[model samples]
Target chain A: MTEAIQNVANPQIEVKDLNLWYGDKQALKNVSIQIPKNSVTAFIGPSGCGKSTFIRCLNRMNDLIKSCRIEGEVSIEGKDIYGPGVDVVDLRKQVGMVFQKPNPFPMSIYDNIAYGPRIHGVNKKDLEGVVEHALRSAALWDEISDRIRSPAFSLSGGQQQRLCIARTMAVKPEIILFDEPCSALDPISTAKIEELIMNLKKDYTIVIVTHNMQQAARISDHTAFFLMGELIEFGKTRQIFENPGEKSTEDYITGRFG
Target chain B: MGLNAKTSERIAFAFLTLAALTVAGFVLFILYYIVSNGYNAISIEFLTEMPRKMMTEGGIYPAIVGTIYLIIGSMLVALPMGILAAIYLTEYAGQNRTTWAIEMAINNLAGTPSVVFGLFGLAMFVKYLGFGPSLLSASLTLGLLIIPVIIRSSEEALLAVPPEYREASLALGISKWQTIRHVVLPASIPGIVTGSILSIGRVAGETAPILLTGAAYFLPRLPDSVYSQFMALPYHLFVLATAGTNIAQTRPLQYGTALVLLMIVLAVNFVAVLVRRYYRQKLKI
Candidate 1:
């Protein structure tokens, strides 16, 4: 754990004693972790283990849900995001998110990518370039450049998911949160998104929630294991997968118990 | 011990065909009766000219213009208020006791009798506001009458928009108002237009509200302003059919007016269907 923390000089996101509840039911229990700057950190847990809930808190997506209550500090770039006077809109701009399912707006593909930048009031002079850049970053520009005006729903399922990624990238967020982004994709599309994530690490800090242990081991530099609302272990991806410090982490990675 | 499968299948087919033909036959019989009686009087003179002094020679021009005025006026008043109320109910208001109560109130308002609305409109707009028995007063009355329909339909349209769209916009750091303006409203425009058109159809055909608040006699000229008195098709037909002294003489004019009104209503409905189809095609891509 110390070696993993030492490898990265500057951390991008530091969550301290974060707890979340949905009315009377608690979802996350005192989760604390440091995510390194410009590195991929994967959260691995079974379904309903609060991994998705924790990611939603990073971008304030949980705010829209009724009966959701979040506690403790979640900070990005040394600023506490949940502190008083924090504008959730500004926080979301800095921290973008992709959902598990592909949810393109019922509009054209160009509009879907351009939507974020347009809302944030990006100048018209720069919008065309920005949209192109985002789509390119998501590795979807080549297939879609000729027919950008086509409706987004015309795209294949994998393509739609990539378009969602492009939409997130258009806003130029510092940190991107992914909630089981590849869970709905096949092996081919999943591999493509994984490759895109690896490339994206050079520019954006990524926090991913994935049920696939192999995916977490393959793409993430740092990994955190969660089970039943508790953070069981956190370490370098290599260490966590190869030789975990805790028995529970080993058991989960080895398919002993989810 | 075995059933005759082929015979049973033939019997079922025969029963289904008979039931379908029965409904079709009833509808066609009513349509044939209305059209044969209404179609003979439809002509250029019967459409463009006003009712003659002798009560036999002219058309339903005044009533046609009055129906248009009443429908347009009602739409102008009801559409904005209905959309705003729907937005407040669905987007801003929490799903609590107050919202539930409001929803219940609107549903009951929709179920209220048209005559009750006419009485209410007479008391409120005519007696209290002193607008008089004019086009404006009638329009206001009809507007109140159709607001419940608009509210219910617009709310349903807005609700039809998936929750994922809102979540996506919020996750992109867009403000709630901005999200609704750019995404939700644009997607729901087809539904809104359909609802508005349906409400307008109701306004055109409504007779009770107009009877309570509008001019009972035919006006030679079109209404010059919102407050001016005007003759509507429904009121004109009612008078021509029932109260006119020369019933045998004015019967053609009455049938002509009814036909024109039916055509206008049908045209409006056709346009709504076309608009919906256009939007559906656009949304499919």
Candidate 2:
């Protein structure tokens, strides 16, 4: 436990020998990686490569699926989250997640940001400040501060996605997981979210699953390449993209075969 | 163009128009018939006063009050149980054989005859529980009759609430119960309320169930409590239409009661339509 704590002091997440299956189909296999603290780490892969599945495992979102079975050690802040008696809710609180599609709750923008804090018992009096701070962190407050009471659906798709990011930030989670956050947005919106993600790493650890290699190269400090549910390569983003050591990595990044 | 093809296309178009007009004409005919017969019987006094001197001398106040009581009473009994059962079916229960069986049972319950439900109510509430022939027994019978309807509608409403809402709430680390309370219920409220209003309409027009379990013949007063004996519109209308005293002189009274009963049923259905429209408008925004 003490050694685990030492490892976590410098890393936000540590997964060891992780494997996952959905009924008879294995989605991940013997994957191990360290996500460093206060940095952006991007997972780049083709669709169905288990990038999203691995991140969902970080917050225990896979537990919601009936046939899903996970085997491995996933620890956050040196505590093994998969250990017995560990509260999945607590784990999720510390590790917030944003999904592929922008899903703002059917509510006002202010309420969307306040939802997380309120659930975790943030005081009503302090809620406004939290909401404002989160919106500002997500780079959305300047655009939406005047219409915080408007329904979130009123926002453009890009703005709604940012509001979702703001909602995750409002909970003050230590780690934020983005599952293809930019996949559904326009180029301008994608660029905006990418910029916001880069800035967010100054204060929070971010793990993003993205298919855009240029995005991983531009914003991420480290990148992990996954294929067929296996972690093919992991290293500095510049090293992986500019001069990949593995032939498969070279072929994929060079647009040979996704 | 081939003559046969062209002629057949024209025939098809003509038949389609005829079918549309036929439906419209049928609806208009029914409305005209009801209005032609019912217009003269409707009066302010007919609506506001109770049946007097064996329904020959007064209005349908007792019947109106009784219908209201029946609807309110049935809704009070059915709403909680229906919503809870819907929640269990949609959110908690897995899609297993048992859950499928329960769903089939609920669907079958919805299709059961109203008279059969009346018999069940008589056996269960009036006879076994010894509630006597009173408002309570009548309400319980009607509630049972409508519970399946409410459950089916509520389940559909709950299911219609986008799964994304549940995921958003759960992803925020909200407990499942809290997610249901804060997100699922609020979104489903309009649907549930609309379904309940529809169930109220069913209870308002139901005559067979009340006949089996409620008080018989004329009652001079409104039900003062849940357990009090009461008069209802459907039973009163049925009795006046078929077996009222002073048949020649009391024909107008019988017509008035029938018109009043029709109005009550229409009013309940109209309110339900309004509620559904209101929810749809809110959902659009």
Cα TM-score per model? 0.93, 0.93
Cα-based lDDT for every prediction? 0.87, 0.86
Candidate 2 per-residue lDDT, tens place, B57-169, comes to 77778788988888888888899889999999988999899999998998888899999999999999999999988889998898888888889888888898988788877
TM-score of 2: 0.93
Give lDDT tens digits, candidate 1, residues A185-254.
Answer: 9999999999999999999999999999999999999899999898888888998999998888898899
CAPRI tier for the interface of model 2: medium
Candidate 1: docking tier? medium
Top candidate by DockQ: 1
- The residue-level lDDT of candidate 2 at A129 comes to 97
Interface root mean square deviation per prediction: 1.4, 1.8
Off by over 4 Å in 1: A1-8, B1-26
Name the lDDT value of residue A197 in candidate 2: 95
lDDT of 2 by residue, A1-258 (tens): 123223433777888989999999999999888889999999998889999999999999999999999998998878999999998887788888998899998888999899889988999999999999999999999998999988899899999999999998888888999999999999999999999999999888999999999999999998889999998888778888888878888998999987
List ranges where model 2 is wrong by over 4 Å.
A1-9, B1-24, B246-251, B273-285
DockQ of candidate 1 against the true complex:
0.71
